[model samples]
Target chain A: MTKELFIQGNQACSMGAIEAGCRFFAGYPITPSTEIAEDLAISLPKVGGSFIQMEDELSAIGAIIGASWSGLKSMTATSGPGFSLMQENIGFAHMSETPIVIVNVQRGSPSTGQPTMTGQGDMMQARWGSHGDYEPIAISPSSVQEFFDFTVKGFNLSEKYRVPVILLADEIVGHMRERVLIPDKTEIFKRVAPYENSSDFLPFKADENGTSPMPAFGDGYKVHITGLTHGELGYPSSSPDDHSNLVRRLTNKTLKNRKDIVSVDLKYCDDADIVLISYGSPVRSIIETVKLAREEGIKIGYLKINTIWPFPEEEIAKLNCDDIFVVELNLGQIVYEVERVVKSNANVHLIGEIGGRLPKPTDILDKIKDLV
Target chain B: MKKEIRIGGFGGQGVILSGVIIGKAAALFDRKNSIQSQSYGPEARGGASKSEVIISDEEINYPKIQNPDVLVAISHEALLKYHTDLKRNGILIVDPDLAHMSEISEFIEKNEIKVYQAKVTKIATEEIGLRIVANIVMIGVITKITNIISVDSAKKAIIDTVPKGTEEKNIKAFDAGYNLDFN
Candidate 1:
């Protein structure tokens, strides 16, 4: 039986990570996301898991990467400013094919705009913040329930692909308390451990799914890792050809299997004329607006983006709507991506605001009314 | 029909918690779909705070309430800040001890919108000796008047969500508010 209880989004995210078999957490205290670290600090120790408060966000991600390589499922969390600092190491995780989860409880920022307020400004940052061409899995949860569910999915995707996965949650969703029905422990998915016979371990060798079987230290695999381009044997390579092949494999693994990674919740979109695209905390607003518009006799629908990065372009491009309105906290971040996928097939309008505020239902409804 | 509600009050008054509890009751107990969102400026106490909830039978598209169908103001500041956004036919529920009823009454009379005034603080403090449960009292009144969810379901939700030892006092506060004559 599933038990429903009121919980903060940050706490749910922490529990989700724990339930998903994450045994290690490394984080720095920051507003909105601090509850996650606090919860994990207390909860992880009880479950025989390890929790560390690193000196900084960069060090936090670095520690998580180290822990992941040691054969333990690991994750770290931070907000905008701290997320900015973790970018370089995030790129390293992608290159080294490290399976680690990074939770970014997004606050308002170009640079420290607001610490305790909410914003979706990090949507683009979650994709390109690391300054590279790699495709990372970024899951955005609109409700406290999805916050928990997607954190588990984030772990699964990270471990399955050997890449860093980000849980892109905003301050509103992170801090707000709501009832979330927690699934039973037996229903949770645990990661697959490395095979036996430690002497014959090949660290970077891909399985049928393109995921490398990771063997940790003390397991006697004698694995060697570096930030530079590495061969299948985990040795650094200087040749451009090797670098190109390695980067391509790392990036292609996630992009090619996007169909398996992407998840979305569609409401009344099958026969709709207008599509309202939104994610994270803003989806709640979009849901209400669409219902009200329907009462007013408008043929409107909604697409709630749960899997934000690897951009779900294929699924969005298939919508044969006359107009699509992308609602978000930033001024046209996800809207640009929506436009890229939709092209000239449908009219796309950007409904957004900044400075830790959300786009209201009336604004979205008014845009839908204008377009229709 | 879709209803957007905004409950505003000082911190520690349980205004945000009330919004969430109501949303949960509506969504889980009543089998309706709901969403709750809250905002508070810096300070933990005596700060301007408001929580918005949207409940509907169908899928909810927008979460933030621009023009709330129902507004519950527990402080004078919240009444002044959010009254303008109340829908034309919306119900404005206020605590007379914290806010001057005349202003809200005048707006109601001028706009012909419904107004319900409850001496929530006095009832909670004097009768129940649990002044902090005023938000729960207000929730009872709002639930009864709106008929959005049954009283039994609301009580069950209160029982299920409130902390262990606090349930009895909350139930008493809710009953007192529910039985209060608004006519």
Candidate 2:
């Protein structure tokens, strides 16, 4: 039987990770995201998984990568400053195509602006923060329940794509308490293992979808990894062709399957004159604002992106609405992405906040009223 | 229907815990939807802190309490800070000894809000023998006055939320507040 536990968002994320067969956790305690580490620290051991508190965020991601290679699903959780520390490693994980979950319970940023306050400033950071052209799979959940469900999805996506999946949650959603019904058992997604013989196994060989099946460290396969561009055999290669081929394949894997990787919860958008594009905590206020706007006889629709990156440009491109408002907790991060997609077609407005506050329903409604 | 609730007190008074218990009672036990959020920062250390909850039969979208229907204030600062935001005909639950008695009396006469009084801190300290259980006591009192959550369900939630070995005393503290003659 499924038991309903009234837990905070961070707890739900931890539970989801465990249920998704995360056997190892390595994290440095960071505010707003510390509860995830705390919960996993206690729960992982009881579930026969190993938990380690790394010295810093660099080691946190590094340990998870090492653990992933060793055949155990692993993850780490952090906030802005910690996330900044993990970016170089985030790129490394992407380059290695390691299946690991990184939960960034986002707090005020730039440099620990406000430890306990909320911010969506990390949206762009989640994608390009690692300093490369690699496409990252990141999801920003709107509610506590999705915090649980999405972490499961995050792990599955990581394993499926052979990529590092980031669950981009903000402090408000991470700290809020709500009812979460977790089932006793859930279907788990494990990485595909090698189908080739040990003698013929190639670590970096791409499948049709560009994902190379990962074998466990001791699973009768010799694997070598390097930060430099490598070919199918996993040896370092500095040749332009090898480097181009490696990076292109890495980016293509995500871009080719972008539709499957991107999902949005669309509400009343078919006939909406104005559609609001939102995610995470701001979606709550947007929902309420739509209800109020309806009472005023205004038609408002919304497209909430639970999957933040591999940005759902296609969804915005398909919308026929006159105006699309990109609402986020950060100033003009997602709006730019929306603008790039809806250029010369729809007016893309930014209803954004930096930190210390979230977008209120009335605030959005007032913006709609001005447009109407 | 949706009911907005604010449980306010000093940082150490377990104000946030009380809100979580109430939210869990309604969401987990009553099978309704409840959302709980809190105030953080420096005020949480010594001045004033609060936890806000919204319980609804339908799914909750906007989690903030714009004008709370039920207000539970356990500190002097909380009472003054939140009364202006309390809706008329709303239920205001306060610890009379903790707040300015004269201001509360004047506000009661000037406004048409229903007011319930209990020495929540005193009862928890005196009857329950633990000052921390005062928030649980406040939970009991609020549940009784508003009937937003059943005593049994709220008690179960309290037991589930508090640390082990302290459940019994917390339940007793709840009873102390529930049993108070606030009429």
Candidate 3:
């Protein structure tokens, strides 16, 4: 039987990771995100998995990437500063096509701005922070339940695409506790093992799905992995053709599958002219604001971005709205994305905040009132 | 119906845990919708800490508390800081031993707040033989006074939350507060 429990968002993320067959967790304790590592430390060993507290964020991501190669669904959780430190390795994980889950319970940024506060400043960072041209997959959760469900989704996406998936959560969602109904069993996504014989296996070759099957360390396959641009055999090659092909394939795998990879929750958008788009914690306030605006006879719709990366351009572009309000915790990170997609079509407005305060519903309603 | 609650006290007083218990009771056992959030200083103890919860029969869109329907202030600083934010006729639970009621008598009277003076710390230390269970005692007072959560649900939540081997004493502390004659 399924059991409903009151659990924190971070704790749910940990449980979701465990339920998704995550057998290894490597993390360094940081506020807002520490609970994830703490919960996993106690739960992992009991489930026959392993948990290791590395010295710093760099080593934490490194350890998980190494563990993922050993055939375990590995993950790590961190905040802004730690997330910044993990960028180089995050790029490596992308280049190497390593399947791992990185949960960034985002706090204030640019440096370690606020340790215990929430920030959505890492939206662009999640997409472009790793310092490469490769497309990344990021999913943000607006509620504790979504935090649990999305963590599992993140692993599924990672394994399916053979990429590093970021579960982009903020401190407000990370620290808040709510009811989460956990089922007795979860559907796990298993990575495909190479089908070729040992003598004919090409480590970097892609199947029809645009992702190569991965074999564990002791799978008796000819596997040579490198961060440098590699060919089908997985050996480093300096040839321009090899580098372009590798990068294009890496970027195209996510771009071509954007429809399947991206999801949004649209409410009352079919008949409304003003759509409010938001993700993470800000979505809660937007939902409340939409309700209040509708009660006042104003037709305000809500478009919540569940998948933060690959940008959800199609959904934003299809909205025939007069105005679109992009709400986030930072100073206009995702607002620009809205502008880029809805260029000259609708007025894009930004309701951004900093210093740990959530964007209030009253304020959001007031903005909608001004527009109406 | 939606009820917003805020529990405030110094750190190490289990202010956060008390809120967690109330929320857990409502959400897990009573089958209501609840959201619990907390804010505290960097210090592990002594600084003013607060935990806010919103329990609703319907979906809770905004996870933050606007104006508290019930404010549980267990310390002097907590009472002084949050007394004005209570809604009219809202239930206010305070520990008389830690927070002096005389300081906020004017505001409490003006707001028509129903104040319950629970000596939860005294009962936990002297009667229950454990000061750490004072929060559980306060949870008992909250359950009985507000009627937001059932006695059985609150007790089940306490058992589900508190550490092992101490559930019995914690329940005893809860009974002490629940049995207090406020009439």
For DockQ, candidate 2 versus 3, the one ahead is 3
* Candidate 1 chain B weakest lDDT stretch, 10 residues: B57-66
- Candidate 1 per-residue lDDT, tens place, A1-372, comes to 887766789989998988898999999998879999999999999999999999999899999999988889999999989999999999999988889999999988778778779988888888998876788899999888889989988998888888899999999889876668889862444555568566666777777767777777677777788888888778988988878877888888988898889988898998889988989988888887888889988888999999998898988999988999888888789999999999999999888878776776776787777656
Look at candidate 2 and tell me the lDDT of residue B153: 91
Ranking of all candidate structures by their lDDT, best first: 3, 2, 1
TM-scores for every candidate against the unseen true structure? 0.87, 0.96, 0.98
Of candidates 3 and 1, the better by lDDT? 3
Report how far off residue A325 is in candidate 2 (Å). Answer: 1.3
CAPRI category for model 3: high
Which pairs clash (backbone N, Cα, C closer than 3 Å) in model 3?
A: none
For candidate 2, lDDT tens digit of each residue in B98-175? 886567676766778888888888888888789888888898899889999999899999999889998899899988
Candidate 3 CA-lDDT value: 0.92
Error of 1 at A186 (Å): 7.3
Candidate 2 interface RMS: 1.4
How good is model 2 by TM-score?
0.96
**TM-score of chain B, candidate 3?**
0.98
In terms of lDDT, which candidate is strongest?
3
